[model samples]
Target: MTEPTSANADREVLQMIPKPATAPEIGPWLWAMEETRRGLLRTVRGLEQDALDWRGASGEDNSIGSLLYHIALVELSWLYEDMLLVEPPADIVALLPHPSRAPQGGLQHVESETLAQHLERLEKARADFMRHLTPMTEADWHTFREPPDTDYAVTPAWAVFHLVEHEAGHLFQIREILRRWRAQERAAP
Candidate 1:
Protein backbone atom coordinates (compact mmCIF):
# COMPACT_ATOMS: atom_id res chain seq x y z
CA MET A 1 0.00 0.00 0.00
CA THR A 2 1.09 3.59 -0.61
CA GLU A 3 1.96 5.91 2.29
CA PRO A 4 0.31 9.23 2.84
CA THR A 5 1.82 12.65 2.21
CA SER A 6 1.45 15.81 4.27
CA ALA A 7 -0.82 18.56 3.01
CA ASN A 8 0.73 21.95 2.30
CA ALA A 9 -0.48 24.29 5.03
CA ASP A 10 0.02 27.28 2.76
CA ARG A 11 -2.56 26.23 0.25
CA GLU A 12 -5.40 28.77 0.30
CA VAL A 13 -8.35 26.57 -0.71
CA LEU A 14 -8.50 23.50 1.48
CA GLN A 15 -12.13 23.77 2.35
CA MET A 16 -15.02 21.72 1.00
CA ILE A 17 -17.87 23.63 -0.56
CA PRO A 18 -20.87 22.70 -2.69
CA LYS A 19 -20.37 22.59 -6.45
CA PRO A 20 -20.83 25.95 -8.07
CA ALA A 21 -24.30 26.87 -9.40
CA THR A 22 -25.90 23.87 -7.76
CA ALA A 23 -28.72 23.76 -5.25
CA PRO A 24 -27.40 25.12 -1.98
CA GLU A 25 -29.13 22.41 0.01
CA ILE A 26 -27.37 19.49 -1.70
CA GLY A 27 -24.29 21.18 -3.08
CA PRO A 28 -21.96 19.92 -0.37
CA TRP A 29 -22.72 16.31 -1.20
CA LEU A 30 -22.41 17.02 -4.89
CA TRP A 31 -19.06 18.69 -4.36
CA ALA A 32 -17.82 15.80 -2.29
CA MET A 33 -18.80 13.30 -5.00
CA GLU A 34 -17.18 15.47 -7.65
CA GLU A 35 -13.97 15.70 -5.68
CA THR A 36 -13.92 11.97 -5.12
CA ARG A 37 -14.44 11.45 -8.84
CA ARG A 38 -11.63 13.88 -9.65
CA GLY A 39 -9.30 11.76 -7.56
CA LEU A 40 -10.46 8.66 -9.43
CA LEU A 41 -9.84 10.26 -12.81
CA ARG A 42 -6.44 11.48 -11.71
CA THR A 43 -5.45 8.02 -10.58
CA VAL A 44 -6.33 6.42 -13.91
CA ARG A 45 -5.32 9.17 -16.26
CA GLY A 46 -3.31 8.17 -19.38
CA LEU A 47 -3.63 4.44 -18.80
CA GLU A 48 -3.09 2.46 -21.98
CA GLN A 49 -5.27 -0.43 -23.11
CA ASP A 50 -3.04 -3.04 -21.53
CA ALA A 51 -3.03 -1.15 -18.25
CA LEU A 52 -6.81 -0.91 -18.32
CA ASP A 53 -7.14 -4.65 -19.05
CA TRP A 54 -4.35 -5.95 -16.86
CA ARG A 55 -5.18 -8.62 -14.29
CA GLY A 56 -2.54 -9.87 -11.90
CA ALA A 57 -0.78 -13.17 -12.76
CA SER A 58 -3.42 -15.09 -10.86
CA GLY A 59 -6.02 -13.65 -13.23
CA GLU A 60 -8.58 -13.65 -10.41
CA ASP A 61 -8.63 -9.99 -9.53
CA ASN A 62 -10.66 -7.41 -11.41
CA SER A 63 -9.12 -5.51 -14.31
CA ILE A 64 -8.97 -1.74 -14.00
CA GLY A 65 -11.51 -1.52 -16.79
CA SER A 66 -13.87 -3.75 -14.84
CA LEU A 67 -13.54 -1.57 -11.78
CA LEU A 68 -14.21 1.52 -13.84
CA TYR A 69 -17.35 -0.01 -15.26
CA HIS A 70 -18.42 -1.11 -11.81
CA ILE A 71 -17.99 2.39 -10.45
CA ALA A 72 -20.21 3.92 -13.09
CA LEU A 73 -22.79 1.15 -12.79
CA VAL A 74 -23.03 1.50 -9.04
CA GLU A 75 -23.47 5.24 -9.26
CA LEU A 76 -26.38 4.92 -11.62
CA SER A 77 -27.85 2.01 -9.69
CA TRP A 78 -27.78 3.92 -6.43
CA LEU A 79 -29.29 6.96 -8.02
CA TYR A 80 -32.22 5.11 -9.51
CA GLU A 81 -32.77 2.13 -7.24
CA ASP A 82 -31.91 3.40 -3.78
CA MET A 83 -32.62 7.12 -4.04
CA LEU A 84 -35.41 7.23 -6.56
CA LEU A 85 -36.94 3.92 -5.41
CA VAL A 86 -37.36 2.66 -8.93
CA GLU A 87 -35.72 0.40 -11.48
CA PRO A 88 -32.96 2.03 -13.49
CA PRO A 89 -34.48 3.84 -16.40
CA ALA A 90 -33.88 2.61 -19.92
CA ASP A 91 -31.22 5.16 -20.73
CA ILE A 92 -29.28 4.43 -17.57
CA VAL A 93 -29.50 0.73 -18.34
CA ALA A 94 -28.27 1.47 -21.81
CA LEU A 95 -25.20 3.15 -20.35
CA LEU A 96 -24.26 -0.07 -18.57
CA PRO A 97 -24.51 -2.98 -21.00
CA HIS A 98 -23.36 -5.56 -18.48
CA PRO A 99 -24.99 -6.86 -15.33
CA SER A 100 -23.66 -5.69 -12.00
CA ARG A 101 -22.26 -9.07 -11.06
CA ALA A 102 -21.22 -12.15 -12.94
CA PRO A 103 -22.88 -15.53 -12.59
CA GLN A 104 -20.06 -16.57 -10.28
CA GLY A 105 -20.91 -13.66 -7.95
CA GLY A 106 -17.97 -11.38 -8.67
CA LEU A 107 -17.84 -8.06 -10.43
CA GLN A 108 -18.33 -8.88 -14.08
CA HIS A 109 -14.92 -8.65 -15.69
CA VAL A 110 -15.04 -5.93 -18.32
CA GLU A 111 -12.63 -6.29 -21.22
CA SER A 112 -12.06 -5.17 -24.84
CA GLU A 113 -13.64 -1.76 -24.12
CA THR A 114 -11.17 1.05 -24.61
CA LEU A 115 -10.34 3.42 -21.76
CA ALA A 116 -12.14 6.09 -23.75
CA GLN A 117 -15.31 4.01 -23.72
CA HIS A 118 -15.06 3.47 -19.98
CA LEU A 119 -14.61 7.18 -19.44
CA GLU A 120 -17.55 7.97 -21.67
CA ARG A 121 -19.80 5.63 -19.68
CA LEU A 122 -18.64 7.16 -16.43
CA GLU A 123 -19.22 10.67 -17.73
CA LYS A 124 -22.71 9.87 -18.91
CA ALA A 125 -23.67 8.24 -15.62
CA ARG A 126 -22.34 11.19 -13.64
CA ALA A 127 -23.99 13.80 -15.82
CA ASP A 128 -27.35 12.09 -15.51
CA PHE A 129 -26.96 11.69 -11.75
CA MET A 130 -26.02 15.35 -11.28
CA ARG A 131 -28.86 16.55 -13.46
CA HIS A 132 -31.30 14.62 -11.28
CA LEU A 133 -29.77 15.98 -8.09
CA THR A 134 -29.48 19.63 -9.18
CA PRO A 135 -33.16 20.39 -8.69
CA MET A 136 -33.62 18.48 -5.42
CA THR A 137 -35.36 20.19 -2.51
CA GLU A 138 -34.28 19.85 1.11
CA ALA A 139 -37.09 17.42 1.76
CA ASP A 140 -36.11 15.29 -1.20
CA TRP A 141 -32.60 15.07 0.10
CA HIS A 142 -33.75 13.70 3.44
CA THR A 143 -36.57 11.42 2.34
CA PHE A 144 -35.78 7.75 2.90
CA ARG A 145 -36.74 4.87 0.66
CA GLU A 146 -37.52 1.57 2.32
CA PRO A 147 -37.76 -1.13 -0.27
CA PRO A 148 -39.83 -4.06 0.93
CA ASP A 149 -37.41 -6.64 -0.38
CA THR A 150 -34.63 -5.39 1.89
CA ASP A 151 -34.50 -4.69 5.61
CA TYR A 152 -32.76 -1.32 5.19
CA ALA A 153 -33.70 2.13 4.01
CA VAL A 154 -31.56 5.00 2.76
CA THR A 155 -31.91 8.72 2.30
CA PRO A 156 -30.46 10.30 -0.79
CA ALA A 157 -27.79 11.89 1.40
CA TRP A 158 -26.68 8.57 2.84
CA ALA A 159 -26.69 6.95 -0.59
CA VAL A 160 -24.45 9.68 -1.95
CA PHE A 161 -22.05 9.22 0.94
CA HIS A 162 -21.95 5.50 0.34
CA LEU A 163 -21.28 6.05 -3.34
CA VAL A 164 -18.35 8.31 -2.55
CA GLU A 165 -16.77 5.79 -0.20
CA HIS A 166 -17.41 2.94 -2.62
CA GLU A 167 -15.63 4.69 -5.46
CA ALA A 168 -12.76 5.77 -3.23
CA GLY A 169 -12.14 2.17 -2.18
CA HIS A 170 -12.04 1.03 -5.80
CA LEU A 171 -9.76 3.91 -6.71
CA PHE A 172 -7.30 2.63 -4.13
CA GLN A 173 -7.48 -0.84 -5.66
CA ILE A 174 -6.96 0.57 -9.14
CA ARG A 175 -3.90 2.46 -7.97
CA GLU A 176 -2.41 -0.68 -6.46
CA ILE A 177 -3.11 -2.61 -9.63
CA LEU A 178 -1.42 0.03 -11.74
CA ARG A 179 1.66 -0.09 -9.53
CA ARG A 180 1.86 -3.88 -9.70
CA TRP A 181 1.30 -3.89 -13.43
CA ARG A 182 4.13 -1.44 -13.98
CA ALA A 183 6.47 -3.50 -11.86
CA GLN A 184 5.53 -6.63 -13.77
CA GLU A 185 6.12 -4.88 -17.07
CA ARG A 186 9.56 -3.72 -16.00
CA ALA A 187 10.52 -7.20 -14.77
CA ALA A 188 9.53 -8.93 -17.99
CA PRO A 189 12.53 -10.30 -19.98
Candidate 2:
Protein backbone atom coordinates (compact mmCIF):
# COMPACT_ATOMS: atom_id res chain seq x y z
CA MET A 1 0.00 0.00 0.00
CA THR A 2 1.21 3.49 -0.86
CA GLU A 3 1.86 5.87 2.07
CA PRO A 4 -0.24 9.04 2.30
CA THR A 5 1.64 12.17 1.34
CA SER A 6 2.12 15.06 3.85
CA ALA A 7 0.01 17.32 1.64
CA ASN A 8 -2.82 14.82 1.76
CA ALA A 9 -2.48 14.50 5.53
CA ASP A 10 -2.55 18.26 5.96
CA ARG A 11 -5.58 18.81 3.70
CA GLU A 12 -8.62 20.15 5.51
CA VAL A 13 -11.89 18.32 4.96
CA LEU A 14 -14.96 20.53 4.77
CA GLN A 15 -18.22 19.09 5.98
CA MET A 16 -21.17 20.98 4.52
CA ILE A 17 -23.38 19.81 7.36
CA PRO A 18 -21.40 18.24 10.15
CA LYS A 19 -23.02 15.98 12.71
CA PRO A 20 -22.18 16.57 16.36
CA ALA A 21 -21.14 13.38 18.14
CA THR A 22 -23.30 14.08 21.18
CA ALA A 23 -26.51 15.17 19.43
CA PRO A 24 -26.85 13.90 15.93
CA GLU A 25 -30.44 14.97 15.51
CA ILE A 26 -29.78 18.72 15.46
CA GLY A 27 -26.07 18.45 14.83
CA PRO A 28 -26.25 19.62 11.26
CA TRP A 29 -28.14 22.74 12.27
CA LEU A 30 -25.67 23.49 15.03
CA TRP A 31 -22.78 23.01 12.64
CA ALA A 32 -24.27 25.44 10.14
CA MET A 33 -24.84 28.04 12.86
CA GLU A 34 -21.29 27.65 14.11
CA GLU A 35 -19.96 28.05 10.60
CA THR A 36 -21.89 31.27 10.19
CA ARG A 37 -20.63 32.61 13.51
CA ARG A 38 -17.07 31.69 12.72
CA GLY A 39 -17.29 33.32 9.31
CA LEU A 40 -18.59 36.54 10.80
CA LEU A 41 -15.86 36.55 13.45
CA ARG A 42 -13.13 35.82 10.95
CA THR A 43 -14.36 38.64 8.72
CA VAL A 44 -14.23 41.15 11.57
CA ARG A 45 -11.13 39.94 13.31
CA GLY A 46 -8.42 42.59 13.86
CA LEU A 47 -10.79 45.43 12.96
CA GLU A 48 -10.34 48.53 15.10
CA GLN A 49 -13.22 50.29 16.83
CA ASP A 50 -13.37 52.93 14.11
CA ALA A 51 -13.83 50.33 11.45
CA LEU A 52 -16.55 48.69 13.49
CA ASP A 53 -18.44 52.00 13.64
CA TRP A 54 -17.94 53.16 10.07
CA ARG A 55 -20.99 53.93 7.92
CA GLY A 56 -21.40 54.17 4.16
CA ALA A 57 -21.48 57.43 2.18
CA SER A 58 -25.26 57.54 2.11
CA GLY A 59 -25.30 57.71 5.94
CA GLU A 60 -26.69 54.19 6.16
CA ASP A 61 -26.93 53.28 9.79
CA ASN A 62 -25.89 49.65 9.99
CA SER A 63 -22.40 49.81 11.43
CA ILE A 64 -20.38 46.65 11.96
CA GLY A 65 -21.00 47.00 15.69
CA SER A 66 -24.74 47.33 15.17
CA LEU A 67 -24.77 44.41 12.75
CA LEU A 68 -22.89 42.25 15.25
CA TYR A 69 -25.30 43.20 18.00
CA HIS A 70 -28.29 42.61 15.74
CA ILE A 71 -27.05 39.16 14.79
CA ALA A 72 -26.80 38.08 18.43
CA LEU A 73 -30.11 39.70 19.38
CA VAL A 74 -32.01 38.03 16.58
CA GLU A 75 -30.53 34.62 17.34
CA LEU A 76 -31.38 34.93 21.02
CA SER A 77 -34.88 36.10 20.21
CA TRP A 78 -35.57 33.21 17.86
CA LEU A 79 -34.13 30.61 20.24
CA TYR A 80 -36.07 31.88 23.24
CA GLU A 81 -39.28 33.18 21.72
CA ASP A 82 -39.71 30.80 18.79
CA MET A 83 -37.92 27.58 19.59
CA LEU A 84 -37.96 27.30 23.39
CA LEU A 85 -41.10 29.47 23.87
CA VAL A 86 -39.63 31.25 26.89
CA GLU A 87 -38.49 34.73 27.80
CA PRO A 88 -34.81 35.35 27.30
CA PRO A 89 -32.81 34.88 30.46
CA ALA A 90 -31.77 37.90 32.52
CA ASP A 91 -28.14 37.80 31.45
CA ILE A 92 -29.02 37.94 27.76
CA VAL A 93 -31.55 40.64 28.37
CA ALA A 94 -28.87 42.68 30.08
CA LEU A 95 -26.47 42.13 27.25
CA LEU A 96 -29.00 43.38 24.68
CA PRO A 97 -31.38 45.77 26.35
CA HIS A 98 -32.49 47.71 23.29
CA PRO A 99 -34.52 46.53 20.36
CA SER A 100 -32.60 45.27 17.36
CA ARG A 101 -34.20 47.89 15.13
CA ALA A 102 -35.24 51.43 15.83
CA PRO A 103 -38.76 52.68 15.17
CA GLN A 104 -37.43 54.09 11.90
CA GLY A 105 -36.63 50.54 10.75
CA GLY A 106 -32.86 50.87 10.86
CA LEU A 107 -30.44 49.06 13.10
CA GLN A 108 -30.08 50.60 16.53
CA HIS A 109 -26.86 52.22 17.54
CA VAL A 110 -24.32 50.08 19.36
CA GLU A 111 -22.38 53.05 20.59
CA SER A 112 -18.66 52.99 21.25
CA GLU A 113 -18.55 49.19 21.30
CA THR A 114 -15.15 47.62 20.76
CA LEU A 115 -14.67 44.55 18.57
CA ALA A 116 -13.91 42.49 21.70
CA GLN A 117 -17.21 43.52 23.26
CA HIS A 118 -19.17 42.64 20.12
CA LEU A 119 -17.42 39.27 19.88
CA GLU A 120 -18.11 38.56 23.54
CA ARG A 121 -21.80 39.22 23.07
CA LEU A 122 -21.91 37.01 20.01
CA GLU A 123 -20.15 34.17 21.88
CA LYS A 124 -22.44 34.48 24.90
CA ALA A 125 -25.56 34.29 22.74
CA ARG A 126 -24.28 31.28 20.82
CA ALA A 127 -23.29 29.50 24.05
CA ASP A 128 -26.77 30.03 25.46
CA PHE A 129 -28.36 28.76 22.26
CA MET A 130 -26.21 25.62 22.24
CA ARG A 131 -26.87 24.96 25.93
CA HIS A 132 -30.58 24.97 25.31
CA LEU A 133 -30.41 23.11 22.02
CA THR A 134 -27.97 20.34 23.02
CA PRO A 135 -30.53 18.36 25.03
CA MET A 136 -33.35 18.44 22.49
CA THR A 137 -34.48 15.13 21.05
CA GLU A 138 -35.28 14.53 17.40
CA ALA A 139 -38.94 15.15 18.20
CA ASP A 140 -38.06 18.46 19.82
CA TRP A 141 -36.22 19.56 16.71
CA HIS A 142 -39.44 19.15 14.73
CA THR A 143 -41.68 20.64 17.41
CA PHE A 144 -43.61 23.68 16.21
CA ARG A 145 -44.77 26.86 17.89
CA GLU A 146 -48.01 28.55 16.90
CA PRO A 147 -48.18 31.77 18.78
CA PRO A 148 -51.47 33.37 19.67
CA ASP A 149 -53.04 35.64 17.04
CA THR A 150 -50.50 34.46 14.48
CA ASP A 151 -51.20 32.50 11.31
CA TYR A 152 -47.77 30.92 11.12
CA ALA A 153 -46.15 28.13 13.08
CA VAL A 154 -42.39 27.54 13.21
CA THR A 155 -40.20 24.60 14.05
CA PRO A 156 -36.89 24.55 15.84
CA ALA A 157 -35.22 23.18 12.74
CA TRP A 158 -36.53 26.06 10.65
CA ALA A 159 -35.53 28.57 13.32
CA VAL A 160 -31.99 27.29 13.34
CA PHE A 161 -31.85 27.43 9.59
CA HIS A 162 -33.14 30.97 9.69
CA LEU A 163 -30.42 31.94 12.13
CA VAL A 164 -27.78 30.64 9.77
CA GLU A 165 -29.28 32.51 6.84
CA HIS A 166 -29.70 35.68 8.86
CA GLU A 167 -26.06 35.71 9.93
CA ALA A 168 -24.87 35.02 6.40
CA GLY A 169 -26.92 37.87 4.94
CA HIS A 170 -25.55 40.30 7.51
CA LEU A 171 -22.05 39.06 7.07
CA PHE A 172 -22.31 40.00 3.41
CA GLN A 173 -23.41 43.46 4.44
CA ILE A 174 -20.45 43.70 6.80
CA ARG A 175 -18.03 42.74 4.07
CA GLU A 176 -19.44 45.41 1.81
CA ILE A 177 -19.21 47.99 4.56
CA LEU A 178 -15.59 47.10 5.20
CA ARG A 179 -14.82 47.33 1.52
CA ARG A 180 -16.44 50.75 1.27
CA TRP A 181 -14.65 52.01 4.36
CA ARG A 182 -11.28 50.87 3.07
CA ALA A 183 -11.92 52.40 -0.32
CA GLN A 184 -12.86 55.70 1.24
CA GLU A 185 -9.69 55.67 3.34
CA ARG A 186 -7.53 54.96 0.32
CA ALA A 187 -9.20 57.71 -1.66
CA ALA A 188 -8.52 60.26 1.09
CA PRO A 189 -5.66 62.70 0.31
Candidate 3:
Protein backbone atom coordinates (compact mmCIF):
# COMPACT_ATOMS: atom_id res chain seq x y z
CA MET A 1 0.00 0.00 0.00
CA THR A 2 1.26 3.49 -0.86
CA GLU A 3 1.52 6.10 1.91
CA PRO A 4 -1.14 8.85 1.82
CA THR A 5 -0.17 12.38 0.72
CA SER A 6 -0.69 15.36 3.10
CA ALA A 7 -3.76 16.52 1.14
CA ASN A 8 -5.40 13.12 1.44
CA ALA A 9 -4.71 12.92 5.16
CA ASP A 10 -6.24 16.37 5.72
CA ARG A 11 -9.36 15.39 3.84
CA GLU A 12 -9.76 12.23 5.87
CA VAL A 13 -9.46 14.20 9.13
CA LEU A 14 -12.06 16.70 7.95
CA GLN A 15 -14.43 13.88 7.09
CA MET A 16 -14.11 12.47 10.61
CA ILE A 17 -15.50 15.63 12.16
CA PRO A 18 -19.30 15.79 12.64
CA LYS A 19 -21.87 18.49 13.37
CA PRO A 20 -21.85 18.00 17.15
CA ALA A 21 -21.90 15.44 19.91
CA THR A 22 -24.82 15.77 22.26
CA ALA A 23 -24.32 12.86 24.59
CA PRO A 24 -21.94 10.31 26.08
CA GLU A 25 -22.69 6.70 25.30
CA ILE A 26 -22.08 3.51 27.17
CA GLY A 27 -23.33 0.45 25.32
CA PRO A 28 -24.50 -1.39 28.44
CA TRP A 29 -26.87 1.46 29.26
CA LEU A 30 -28.69 0.97 25.97
CA TRP A 31 -28.81 -2.78 26.39
CA ALA A 32 -30.29 -2.34 29.83
CA MET A 33 -33.12 -0.17 28.55
CA GLU A 34 -34.05 -2.67 25.84
CA GLU A 35 -34.04 -5.46 28.39
CA THR A 36 -36.34 -3.48 30.63
CA ARG A 37 -38.78 -2.89 27.79
CA ARG A 38 -38.97 -6.60 27.23
CA GLY A 39 -39.57 -7.29 30.90
CA LEU A 40 -42.39 -4.76 31.08
CA LEU A 41 -44.15 -6.42 28.16
CA ARG A 42 -43.71 -9.85 29.69
CA THR A 43 -45.18 -8.74 32.98
CA VAL A 44 -48.41 -7.51 31.44
CA ARG A 45 -49.07 -9.72 28.45
CA GLY A 46 -52.12 -12.03 28.50
CA LEU A 47 -53.11 -10.80 31.94
CA GLU A 48 -56.72 -10.00 32.78
CA GLN A 49 -57.97 -6.48 33.38
CA ASP A 50 -58.04 -6.97 37.11
CA ALA A 51 -54.40 -7.88 37.13
CA LEU A 52 -53.58 -4.63 35.40
CA ASP A 53 -55.85 -2.74 37.77
CA TRP A 54 -54.37 -4.19 40.91
CA ARG A 55 -52.20 -1.98 43.11
CA GLY A 56 -50.43 -3.60 45.98
CA ALA A 57 -52.53 -3.59 49.13
CA SER A 58 -49.49 -1.91 50.76
CA GLY A 59 -47.79 0.35 48.21
CA GLU A 60 -48.32 4.16 48.02
CA ASP A 61 -46.55 4.99 44.76
CA ASN A 62 -48.26 5.34 41.38
CA SER A 63 -49.63 2.34 39.48
CA ILE A 64 -47.99 0.68 36.50
CA GLY A 65 -49.82 3.15 34.24
CA SER A 66 -48.38 6.14 36.02
CA LEU A 67 -44.91 4.66 35.81
CA LEU A 68 -45.31 4.10 32.10
CA TYR A 69 -46.44 7.68 31.66
CA HIS A 70 -43.40 8.86 33.57
CA ILE A 71 -41.13 6.95 31.24
CA ALA A 72 -42.78 8.50 28.18
CA LEU A 73 -42.60 11.90 29.79
CA VAL A 74 -38.84 11.63 30.25
CA GLU A 75 -38.14 10.25 26.77
CA LEU A 76 -40.00 12.90 24.80
CA SER A 77 -39.01 15.66 27.17
CA TRP A 78 -35.33 14.91 26.72
CA LEU A 79 -35.74 14.75 22.97
CA TYR A 80 -37.23 18.22 22.62
CA GLU A 81 -36.28 20.05 25.78
CA ASP A 82 -32.81 19.00 26.83
CA MET A 83 -31.16 17.16 23.96
CA LEU A 84 -32.16 19.78 21.44
CA LEU A 85 -32.71 22.49 24.06
CA VAL A 86 -34.92 24.40 21.70
CA GLU A 87 -36.44 27.82 22.29
CA PRO A 88 -40.23 28.30 21.95
CA PRO A 89 -39.94 24.76 23.02
CA ALA A 90 -41.79 21.65 22.00
CA ASP A 91 -44.66 21.31 24.48
CA ILE A 92 -44.52 17.68 25.45
CA VAL A 93 -46.77 18.16 28.45
CA ALA A 94 -49.64 19.00 26.10
CA LEU A 95 -48.88 15.99 23.94
CA LEU A 96 -48.55 13.67 26.90
CA PRO A 97 -50.71 14.69 29.81
CA HIS A 98 -49.21 14.26 33.23
CA PRO A 99 -51.05 12.70 36.11
CA SER A 100 -52.71 15.15 38.41
CA ARG A 101 -52.02 15.20 42.10
CA ALA A 102 -54.72 13.47 44.11
CA PRO A 103 -55.44 12.17 47.56
CA GLN A 104 -54.39 8.65 48.38
CA GLY A 105 -56.84 5.93 49.32
CA GLY A 106 -54.97 2.67 49.72
CA LEU A 107 -54.90 0.79 46.40
CA GLN A 108 -57.43 3.18 44.88
CA HIS A 109 -54.79 5.89 44.59
CA VAL A 110 -52.67 3.83 42.22
CA GLU A 111 -55.63 2.13 40.56
CA SER A 112 -55.98 5.10 38.24
CA GLU A 113 -55.49 3.46 34.84
CA THR A 114 -55.84 0.35 32.73
CA LEU A 115 -52.82 -1.75 31.73
CA ALA A 116 -53.49 -1.71 28.01
CA GLN A 117 -53.63 2.08 27.83
CA HIS A 118 -50.31 2.36 29.63
CA LEU A 119 -48.60 -0.19 27.41
CA GLU A 120 -49.87 1.34 24.20
CA ARG A 121 -48.66 4.78 25.22
CA LEU A 122 -45.28 3.41 26.23
CA GLU A 123 -44.99 1.55 22.93
CA LYS A 124 -45.48 4.75 20.97
CA ALA A 125 -43.03 6.63 23.13
CA ARG A 126 -40.46 3.90 22.55
CA ALA A 127 -40.96 4.16 18.82
CA ASP A 128 -40.46 7.90 18.88
CA PHE A 129 -37.34 7.55 21.00
CA MET A 130 -35.80 5.01 18.63
CA ARG A 131 -36.53 7.26 15.67
CA HIS A 132 -34.91 10.28 17.27
CA LEU A 133 -31.85 8.32 18.32
CA THR A 134 -31.12 6.47 15.10
CA PRO A 135 -29.96 9.42 13.02
CA MET A 136 -28.47 11.49 15.82
CA THR A 137 -25.55 13.51 14.51
CA GLU A 138 -22.12 12.95 16.01
CA ALA A 139 -21.89 16.68 16.58
CA ASP A 140 -25.15 16.54 18.44
CA TRP A 141 -23.74 14.11 20.95
CA HIS A 142 -20.35 15.79 21.38
CA THR A 143 -21.66 19.33 21.53
CA PHE A 144 -24.29 18.46 24.11
CA ARG A 145 -24.04 20.38 27.34
CA GLU A 146 -25.16 18.80 30.54
CA PRO A 147 -28.73 19.54 31.59
CA PRO A 148 -29.38 20.85 35.07
CA ASP A 149 -31.46 18.90 37.54
CA THR A 150 -32.18 20.73 40.79
CA ASP A 151 -30.83 17.93 42.92
CA TYR A 152 -28.55 16.36 40.33
CA ALA A 153 -25.82 17.63 38.03
CA VAL A 154 -25.95 15.57 34.84
CA THR A 155 -24.08 15.65 31.57
CA PRO A 156 -25.86 14.67 28.36
CA ALA A 157 -24.17 11.29 28.50
CA TRP A 158 -25.27 10.66 32.07
CA ALA A 159 -28.82 11.54 31.13
CA VAL A 160 -28.99 8.63 28.73
CA PHE A 161 -27.62 6.25 31.33
CA HIS A 162 -29.92 7.62 33.99
CA LEU A 163 -33.01 7.39 31.80
CA VAL A 164 -32.22 3.84 30.82
CA GLU A 165 -31.60 2.86 34.42
CA HIS A 166 -34.73 4.66 35.53
CA GLU A 167 -36.85 2.59 33.18
CA ALA A 168 -35.19 -0.58 34.37
CA GLY A 169 -35.90 0.33 37.99
CA HIS A 170 -39.56 0.85 37.21
CA LEU A 171 -39.74 -2.35 35.23
CA PHE A 172 -38.52 -4.19 38.29
CA GLN A 173 -41.25 -2.50 40.27
CA ILE A 174 -43.79 -3.77 37.78
CA ARG A 175 -42.29 -7.21 38.21
CA GLU A 176 -42.88 -7.03 41.94
CA ILE A 177 -46.43 -5.82 41.46
CA LEU A 178 -47.10 -8.76 39.19
CA ARG A 179 -45.55 -11.09 41.68
CA ARG A 180 -47.65 -9.69 44.51
CA TRP A 181 -50.84 -9.83 42.49
CA ARG A 182 -50.20 -13.40 41.42
CA ALA A 183 -49.63 -14.37 45.00
CA GLN A 184 -52.91 -12.79 45.94
CA GLU A 185 -54.65 -14.74 43.20
CA ARG A 186 -53.09 -18.03 44.26
CA ALA A 187 -54.12 -17.39 47.85
CA ALA A 188 -57.72 -16.72 46.91
CA PRO A 189 -60.08 -19.69 47.48
For 63-173, candidate 2 gives per-residue lDDT tens digits of 888999999999988888787777877898998977877888888978688888889999999899888887888887887887555678999889888889999999999
Model 3, 1-189: lDDT tens digits are 354567755564311122222332433444555667777788777766666666567655456666666777677766656665553124335446544445543222435556666777677776666656545554554455545553433344566677777888877887788788889889999
lDDT of 1 at 27: 89
Each model's Cα RMSD: 5.2, 2.8, 11.0
Q: Provide the clash count, candidate 3.
A: 14
Determine the C-alpha RMSD for candidate 1 after optimal superposition of all C-alphas.
5.2
Can you tell me which runs of candidate 3 are displaced by over 4 Å? 1-32, 59-61, 87-95, 100-112, 146-153
lDDT of each: 0.88, 0.85, 0.61
Best by TM-score: 2
User: Where in model 2 is the C-alpha error above 4 Å?
Assistant: 1-10, 16-23
In model 2, which range of ten residues has the least summed lDDT? 14-23
TM-score pick, better of 2 and 3: 2
